[model samples]
Target: MQDFVAGARSAFLRLASHSASDSARSLWADPSGVRGVLRHRLAGPTSAIAFCVLLGAAALGVGNAAVFLGLAGFVAAQVLIARVLQHLGHRLRPDVGFRVVVVTWPIALGALGAAGWTAVNDYHGEVVSLIGLITAGLVALVEPTGFAIVWAVVAAAAVTTGAAVGGSVTGEALVSTGAIAVGAAFGERLRHVIEAFLGNRRELLEETARIPASRDPFQTAERLLQPLVRWTPVKNPSLVWFTPDGRSVFLAVAGNNLPPHLAAGRELPEARNAYMRRQAEQGPWTSGWTVVDGDEGYTRGVASLGIQAGAYVPLVHEGRLLGLLTAGWSAAGGDHSAMAEYIPALVEVAHAAATALGPGLAELEQRSTASQVVDDVLHGQRYWPVYQPIRRLRDSTLVGFEALTRFDAPVTTQRLFIQAGLVGRLRDLEIATMRAAVMEARHLPEDCWLSANASPGLLVDTDLLASILEPIRQPVIIELSEHEVITDYKPIAAALGRLGPRRSLAVDDAGAGFASLRHILEVRPAHVKLDLGLVQGVATDLTRTALVAGFVRFAHDAEFELVAEGIETQEDLDALTRLGVGLGQGYLLGRPERASAAASNENAPRGGRAMGASRVRSRTARTRSQAGAIAASRTTTPAH
Candidate 1:
């Protein structure tokens, strides 16, 4: 069963075994193979030296050969220590399918000493050669490459000792040590090459398996990571999907360390390699691996036992990269070959997982779209206006229209719009809509102005102004909403500063909030539109009447026009006129008419004391005249 398990079509095992064996023979049959198996070949002179020391020690204590063997053992022990140091430095694991062979130098040396003492006590000359051979074999097991060095050292030591102390030089001993070192070196070299070939072949087979099984790239990453986690603990198991632009974004279905910016519109880090190699779109997926050791047990905790070693496998499905799968060994206790052996399997699983996650990916995209829609709305994407006419207070002559927003698409919920913090967008939208309505209005009175709502944000949104200016050439009245009073008003003020001298501003819904009243005083608008709630019952309430009359008087004193909205009764009109209000707009004055009708009234009537209508027209005319003056000033200003 062991043999079957060892040989059962595993390219890794076969390759490793073959490469080791080949490395042993490469020195003789193919020197180039020596380089391939240099790490494993034991072709060195240390073995020969070990042999020489053993014989010398044996001769010195002819009556106690065991003591000599003990000395030889000490030298062998040193060599094993060297081999261990090399292993730790390289982080290479023991050969695959095998346990870590830790031939401790202390134990081996002790054995050598005991054996030599026994040989001397037995007066056995053969024991001398035996010591040389045992040391050679031990060194071979530890580091096949060290064999030559071991053999050469042992041979010289043994020959010298035999000649000087024993008064005899055994050609056989010299020959044996030499032969073993050379043979082991070549054999291990050959073995190493075959192992590599077999390993590559096994990987090809695994890749093929992955091709059919790839269903969900992300899940495959999880599956690939599972065994790694079991073997080596990781703080977080996350995958990065690299883009061609060197950006590596996380495919974070199972990890918590991902950054929020990644989910927004930020691309992955540019250092990601899959993008550079264009392997993100290729199969036999180019796998990129990187390992990080965090401070204070971040990646080195008790939970992460097998993660001392890490491997990353790139996930590619049908030439498209799904992401990357990384797994590590938490503790320092695994074979390097075993670690390498697992990489192919991980790559396959990642491919499978990515392919399977199609439905989830689609859902994620939908959510992304919804989020974008909300953002675009808030930023005023494609928002614009349509115009409705306002009658003149005195002549009811062709007057400007109230610019209103007609959403291209039905936006049913005002709550949704406001909650999105997009009221600013609506203001800009209203402005654009007004500009468009005026530009398209068939015969807008040449001297009339368009009244449009404005949010404080519009002043700061230079881009929004740029858009409107590209298509608009008429005077514009920017009506400030009550809420705009509290928002950052500087940008709006700055924007207003840029408006042609002729443009004017108004405070809309003036009495609804004290904020609006303050804004009107600060902005010094050409007009103030009293809130419908404030104006509707003004005729009946004396206190309200007194307050409104005060506002009307204030408007006149401040050289500002007053317009009343929502006049439903004759009493409302009569009271407003009595209050000295100028412009009146509501059912009594006339419903808001289309732009075309408002522009071409040849016999427009003169209404009586309609404070709101008069206020609106007066503001409009003043705004247009101001805009014309500003344009004239600009034409005359000296160019920088």
Candidate 2:
């Protein structure tokens, strides 16, 4: 019985809340709203005028023009005054008192009765009951539900009593009183139905006018949360966005005073771990406020910031938790508790913000993950650079070495560069790799130039340019690839010029694109390395042979040494030698190797073999007579 009673009581509270919501949305109090547009009880005065004339005529007859004229004149004057008041109300800013008109409705009823009494004879009790029916119906259209019911009761009893006091010699007043009372009850319900329609229309217009764009969803969500922030005394308000992996969450937006510990990124507060667990198991608290501990336990680390407590509202979509919208306060804990009545409204606002922020969060999460990957690579201690020998084809000598970076992750070379650039860490990675390559020079044979690759943007960077000026045992060759476009030649040329005579610049992948050729002409480097595309099948493919032949001629005339890369087979080597290429590097010549002690000690066969034999492979290269023949042919061959 208690449970049933509690359910019944809860239901009644909902009904009352809903009715109050309807009335508040109705805008009857707002002079610039629908009620204002309708001029508040719009048809009430006009209908009152029509009733007064009819009642006065029925009692006095047309021949009694004196009393009838007075009634008609009074009705006209009231109509004019109502119109004037409506116009003034619209013209003013603070709005005229529209609610005052609801009270005047009873006066209109009394006036109608007076008009009947002044004109009539012997229909006393009958006149009172007639006024009751008209007043009830008219008040339904003119006033809100509560006012309509009260006016109906007052008009019925007042008119009936006045007739009896006049001693019209009729006992009919008793019977007619019941008729007036019943009309009041029905009239109130009729007013509520009419008000509900108007209320719905007002709410629809309000929402449509406020929200215009969702292009910047985070900003839009913040703007949407402002109303709730003002209503609640929150010191900190934030919308947290979950990452794709769900391992981390970034503060999409922060409003007001944010807790120092919470900052901008969070997966979940450790303090709320228990709170969330209970909510997950028992279902969340559907209503009321949850007080966050603001005492020493909560305030421990952030003691200086003085955050007393917090309130978190879950942002749920389709039963999945997307994020939390939180509010922090430095005030009394009971402040948020006092706002328990507004919890549902505040939650509704959180729902709207979370919805707008969904797509925005998705985009941020992907970018944030990419940034995290870059940071992990730099600080992870899992990545290192290895050397691949660049051999001189004439003597098969290890003339130079190019550093190739490797990571434990399976990400491709292109993806690594792209992901690093996404986080603005590409230069940092490039500098790290270049430094590693320079360190390898200590383990290498003397006179072997250490070649390191860099993008065009990194070449002009001050730190990299400064690093290029550092003294080394051998010539340092900087190879900028053709994959990136050289946007400005002047700065790269200027920065490279500062490296002095010991440094050499090589335009890598010369046959890859026009940009590499541009790099050769504008920067006028010491060497040009032909791309794998031209060198891969040069012995068989005529077009590849022609392209390499053209690059060889260009390199010679431009006073730059030519190198052909990707020479995996003997045929490719012979072909490149025939093409007058002096240098090459590929897996066939020497695999990239790590020079660590552990690699050799563990007897990791393939890894150790590569490390120990990296220099021996360069020594084992059989001097090709074809390479000398290619040089002879290059001096003799015609344009073909």
Candidate 3:
């Protein structure tokens, strides 16, 4: 099966990183691990010399040629083991070299011990037993869990050879075996503790230091620094964010270890350009912790604190420097030069943090351009309102008109509202638009009602709304769109009550969902408008027909008028009329137009209704070719 091959291929690829043999070797044969343990043992340079002098002067030090020769050979084997561990590459194969050396080491020690005991039988073979005990300790320190496995072969060869040659179950062999068993018992527990600690550390890094999907950049930076300072040698970590102008660096957050002298969350006077120029000239500078050592900026940064050294990791993504993540340490904490092996992991963490803040930083550059355009539009007052006629389905005569905002510029109503909200100017822009619409109400025929869309939040302003509509002779109906929700309308109901006959509320988009249904019941608006999503295909789509039928029944029971919005087709209009809807508005009834053009439509002849509907149908048929691309591109509205 194709699935089986794909799985096998994936497993083959993973073998490079997760081989059992390599896992064992990395634990036992790591060059640095070997060096650190050997440095404290008799095999090391200083200690080896001391050990040789002491062995020569011991009570059983009477020189035997075979044992002396064997000691030279044994020392040679130890040197070879260290050298091979230090220089092992892929071809030198850690598993192969480790197997050969561990086996050869115990054999050489066993042979030397047996030969020396045969020659003298003095000193009770204590020196050989002591070597076995210490060798077991060295294994426990470096390999931990693997000590028991390796010592099995060692005990068999050493004890069997010593007994077969001359000694008869000497007390020395028992001491050596007991020492090894004790170290191995404790070594396994120590290894498990270390493994548990490492697993937790890795999980924390993955959770806190990965590139977030989207978030507040400073919050992400603060999360990243917590564990960096906790687990790593990072003593005092500070994450900085740049101003839009990039002239200053503001510390967003810092770890608890931050020095008392430098209070965080303030802008630093140091010019970022200078540090950047130095990095450009020097190229890819990392002091293992990702900073250039001895740079002038670094020295100045740590001057007041007790920190003697530091790192300045530039958080960059997609060629933009979001900020800098800096960490430092006092002299007593130790140098960062020993962190060379961990540099790759540190760089990975930096990249992830940088990516989290990158998109938010990109938005900053665009804000200036966008804000400027929005300001020009606001100050220029380039937006105006157009009127669309709403007719009674029974008489085919105009009853009201809705005021829709129109812009001379290229922008969608949805995008306009969204951009205004993002810029924190929606309320102001909406107020300005509403004022323009209210001013046009006086021009409407005295017999007709003026309906204008507004958000639910604006319902709280009874006095302001009444004053804005005071100039109009026509009754004003305020309709809140379906896009917004009203949790409780008690305050809104009270506000409208104060205005009395001057204003009445309408719930826009009744049949869409729960928000509109709740608005219908709570506000008890003068009329409820069915959304185009439910009305557009009611003639053909059974689901929409069922939904509109239910809404009609509810409106009839509540004794409130129902207006169907977006009646684009004759089929749609006929469906609403048959369903007992009293009102309808859309392209089919009349296209939105200025007040002068709107006057001719208000009290039209009964014949004009059929003619206007026919013309709308013809225009729709004609423009389907030109507008098809746009209509197709918009995401499905509803009934998805």
Candidate 4:
């Protein structure tokens, strides 16, 4: 029962909202609707004038002064009501204006009925009552069918009562009541016809305003403009698609008769005249179209191109100015008078063009935004580096720090890189970030080393890599992700080879995919870092423990150091140490921090042995043995 009550309540609220919306639309939204007909046809100053003439005829023919005064009072009251409605039309909000119209409508009808009641006994007075009934039906045209019927019935009752009080026959009262009922029914039918016509027009406009499927802006412009040139008196039509900034045109396409300067692929600085430029920027929905004569000073430039008249239409969608559509006529084509007749049709075509070009314009805007973001990061130097400490798992001593990029903008590091790649500035962004990391590495402790990330493509550019890495005085490892697909590793290997003995290569995210094994065999990196997924649950998961053991065996045989990433728990760290993993990094060891904080040893493990003692005993002995084995293996094997 509670669920049923809740459902009924929701249904009722929806119905109420829908009815209110319908009422607002029918009363004031469309210019050709019932509200417009009431203001212009039935309740304007012309209606006031007609009432005044009727007042004069009543005063001249009637001998009863009281009846004449009552009739005159009705006319004055109706004129005042019409004036008030017209005066407040622009001042009130739509809903408020609708309420005012509804409240005043019945009052005006009541006044007319009173005048009809005042003179129902006389022969000339019958004409007055009949006219009042017709006016009451005309007023009903603006009301809902139910309200119109109720108000008409009340007015008919007043007329009938007055006829009986004046000693008129019963048949006469029935005739007066029947007249009002018939008028109300006729008025309701007329209102529905007008509303139907407006609804059809609105639907037609919506159908024509649909987005085109083409992604190319030029093709979209050409397809939309062809209909305008074919159907109307416009002999020459041109479309100027604007750039995202709205400061310049990226593409301009014109009909055959237009000058060569306005041809396809040409950029236009602005529209022909200041008015056209202003109207285009503000959009057609706000400023409408601007028609210019050939002889005008502002149009002299186009006149020289044999164009006699022109109309500028702005292509706007959802308040964004996408482009401008201009239609022109030559002397042989037509004059301003001939073109004026077809201006409405030209506007319809321009509206259709705006809708069809929405997708292409949106894409251009997004690309422009991405380009700007990349430029700010590269040229403005808005990026910096943070360091996450790497530790020796057995002793918990800080071994090295991996430098990662951070930005001033409120965007993810990966997203910035992706945006840069889209704008063809990926290399520039990578190089800039690497250079910043290398510069900040000067602040690190003398005993600690640094590892920085680089793509295979960036490593292939040996000269660019050398310029960034050569300045660092400490040992540096260029870490490459296993996710990148490298068809040729010779260029990258040669680039690292030229960086001298201080620089070494590290294969990052090992054991994450099959490609990491291929990268290990091909590049023969000095260090292979286990992927986080393998290390996260290595404490209990036998499958993850087995994978770590395999990497540990391979690292020993290949003469490479093994590091486990993302050791978040103490159990995982102990598990990795038991598996013979020598180096690791994660939140359990130290989070990434700036150079000053990271280099101060504040982020080091709380009760671990210092690097000085550990380096002398275990790490140095292992490094010396690995270096010796690496040298011997390289001499026997071919270069990768």
- Measured against the true structure, the TM-scores of the candidates, in listed sequence, are 0.38, 0.54, 0.62, 0.53
Weakest 10 consecutive residues of candidate 3 by summed lDDT: 631-640
Return the top candidate by lDDT. Answer: 4
In terms of lDDT, the poorest run of 10 residues in model 2 is 631-640
Off by over 4 Å in 4: 1-250, 256-360, 482-485, 511-518, 540-550, 553-559, 606-640
> What is the model-wide C-alpha lDDT for candidate 1?
0.49
Task: List, residue by residue over 206-264, the lDDT tens digit for candidate 1.
Answer: 55344332434444444434433333223345556553344565554233433343232
Error of 3 at 92 (Å): 4.6
lDDT of each: 0.49, 0.55, 0.58, 0.61
**TM-score sort, best first:** 3, 2, 4, 1
Q: What is the lDDT of residue 47 in candidate 4?
A: 47
Error of 3 at 400 (Å): 3.2
Poorly placed runs, candidate 3 (over 4 Å):
1-77, 86-89, 92-232, 237-254, 257-286, 289-337, 340-384, 394-396, 406-412, 415-426, 439-447, 467-474, 539-559, 578-580, 594-640
